[model samples]
Target: MTRTARPRHYLMCRPTHFEVSYAINPWMDPSKPVDTDLAVAQWERLHALYGELGHRVDLIDPLPGLPDMVYAANGATVVDGKVLGARFRNAERAAEGPAYLDWFRDQGFTTRDPEHVNEGEGDLLLTAGHVLAGRGFRSVTAGHAEAQEFFGRPVVGLELVDPRFYHLDTALSVLDADRDEIMYYPAAFSPGSRAVLARLFPDALLVDEADAEVFGLNAVSDGLHVILPEAATGLAARLRERGFQPIGMDLSELLKGGGSVKCCTLEIRAAA
Candidate 1:
């Protein structure tokens, strides 16, 4: 496939049909349950915000048994025109892949399925030649390696220790690709993980612990855009200072289920 510049399209799952309204995220303790209506409202806000930002959002049909399917982490990605679906490690979330695969096949996507267990769009980040794959919790070491081989690109595994940063998008988000700058939270990432990140993003900025708790370390869309939790006003202001247009929305419901901006959305294809 010849390389042609493609626009980066960000995708977010609408919570209207999400399963697991109980706020039962695999990473979060089962003791803390979620309220259904609040969850719905939170997802609504997020959807509205993303829609206003001009990103193409393809909402999948929510599987009856998987409430977290709205997270869309198990979906497929379109890289160099080939569609790849995940073989997930989380038993409860595995169902998401087939649903997305059905959609991709219907859309005429040339699909590739990984033999090893791999998290979907959540664990992979593509930057030209480098593909940073996340390990620990929802994703595994073997999955990361399989991802590299599957994409036929060099993959760097970022080790995440804390359950809070179960996905790379949770504690590590790319801020600027040209400068190799990222916004990250050290507490959520392991020492070795941070070292790996430093190498990828030598001028990375650390988001405060308090901000990280509020999902402030998530990705900065396109170079000039940022999507953040509405609760983190201070951090939003800081982003504005950096010449970024901050778009804030409520993701409290997703927080109850241990997900935020990056988890709820997957930028499947983007313009370099």
Candidate 2:
């Protein structure tokens, strides 16, 4: 299929207060210091790149002491003018859940406060008229059910086995929603989930461990163009071979916080 670039709207938060104050995930280490300035620079460059591509970019105010707020993708899952609020499992990021809900509500979105634990886009990804939900690490299976009911969409619950790829976005990325094209790391998912992926996306690109470690699957794609981590050389080469214009950006500073390009981006889609 011939691919064309389309303008997308994304929401992001500046890493003004981004830091590893506490260890909620395996990648975070409070013992080691993070370069906040470098993180901001990288984030700004990404923001500019989005603008350069003629994409709409929105921002949310970053509050103090909320270091992980920079990862705006975990805020809420917005679809068809409705938002299913995130129910963070850890207390450290619990406050962020409500903050995002409030923002969505104020923006005229019909918001549903979650009753179960879910990490917004971190665990729930929309593609091919279905929601691929993650569980086992942060989001619960019950949360997947809740999302299914709220979104009025079929939700495929995929269990994450590896702690390194705790979130679904970290393990898989939707390249072409219309074509049901995806890229994923098989080892990150359980045997059953891998089977489900195989059934749903038979032609999905299987990323190797080297690219997966660099968070290559944690990418944002608009069918023809893919923005990914600069270190993911293998993934970049594969994307090119597949006719995707791969744009690499350095988010090494933010990687310390266990987030990359896609981690900092939240796609805003209107109701179908």
Candidate 3:
């Protein structure tokens, strides 16, 4: 397999106000002390790595109260230069939707405020022929249809069965959108969804339990180079075997809030 690298434009937010003050999902625990400084350090490394890989990055200012704002991928879903702003399910992250929307508007990107409760790219992953939408936790089922109508692409609704993998990005990764290549943890999705995936991508990489536990599936791929968690050694090896350059990173501090590389980074895609 020959994988080609593509220049990517991404939006990111600094972990300036990052802290696990409230538990929204299975990964977060307010009782556990969060090192805000360490989270910032880890995030900076990821940001710098993107630059080193020749990717264009844009930053959004983090608000004081919105600690989860650091997870910029949850801010909105952008496809073909059109932006569909997120509507967070949890009240703790409710304000994030508007903040991200405002940024897009200010930047002169065509934006839409979604009607359904959509947690942005956290529950939305893009592929060649479909927008893989995940529900059963963050994004509502109707959000799938809304995305399809907005983006003018087929939307395959996949149900997330595991609480730990609350977001679709947490359980699956699109390694090369051009090649329609992906890898996922079957346990993170419902049985029916697993079958759906099998039919869609017969050669999808199936990751083990250990890799999934380390938030390994929460990865970012720029066609060739895949940025993932350092703890996901198993998944990294698989990616390398499949002709991808897997660059491992440490965002352990952000994991306390239920996110990793894919969560902290939002892709800004233009019409191909």
Candidate 4:
């Protein structure tokens, strides 16, 4: 009999104000909103979908000032049975860690906190042999070493150059398990990071900045399922042709904060 692994559960935050950051290039049209009511409806729809897909979904009250909190993946990490709520490097997002801790405690989760001031979850990437922690952007190299010591797993440090792709999820994601194939954006990864990635998965698919911008090279979930934006239709079609189920959503509001599907959804627990 084939064994089916249990699906991971997560918490998703709703956006309080759907406005884009003016300093960032991609701006959501402030003049026209599809419908504030529809936005609420879509959030509920996603909530329902995750539940239907056999995932435990927790809904958190939206924080007014932190609009990007909906991308929960950036704020937390899960290893084994423990959930680590990250301490965001951005002052605006630091509040999210305590909120996550409270949420997890209420849900009966045993959680861990980063040892240092730097604890953004997006910096940590789970690989077969070890976890690759991006040193630049929101998470620090010290935090990576701490994670290694705590988990007893090797940790590789990486430096991120672009602020837009501040987190590793913005430019890279693990796909196949056995082969360890990764989909990564070339520009966002450092030379050392690339070298480590190549050694782990020699045939890793290198995606471009444009594709990553459109969320085309983010995460591939459950081997066959992928969570990406509607903008990646071509990539979606290719994935479908390869017998993969591509789930697309219109994350227009998330673009304001430079995050997407992978950013907002934190998988707290997954079976090995």
132-187: candidate 1 lDDT, tens digit per residue: 77777766778777766666778888887887677777777766544555677877
Supply the TM-score for candidate 2: 0.98
Score residue 157 of candidate 1 by CA lDDT: 81
Residues 1-272, candidate 3: write the lDDT tens digits: 77889999999999999999888898999999999999999999999999999999999999999999999999999999999999988889999999999999999999989999999999899998899999998899899889999999999999999999999999999998877889999999999999999999999999999999999999999988999999999899988999999999999999999999999999999866
Residue 126 in candidate 1, Cα distance off native in Å: 2.1
Candidate 1 has its poorest 10 consecutive residues by lDDT at 1-10
Task: Order the candidates by TM-score, highest first.
Answer: 3, 2, 1, 4
lDDT of 1: 0.68
- Give the range where candidate 3 is weakest over 10 consecutive residues by summed lDDT: 172-181
122: Cα error in model 1, Å: 1.9
Which model scores highest in lDDT?
Answer: 3
TM-score of 4: 0.83
Cα lDDT, model 2, residue 206: 97
Inter-residue clash pairs, candidate 2: 80-271
> What clash count does candidate 1 reach?
6
How accurate locally, in lDDT, is each candidate?
Answer: 0.68, 0.93, 0.94, 0.66
List where candidate 4 sits over 4 angstroms from the true fold: 1-6, 17-42, 177-179, 270-272
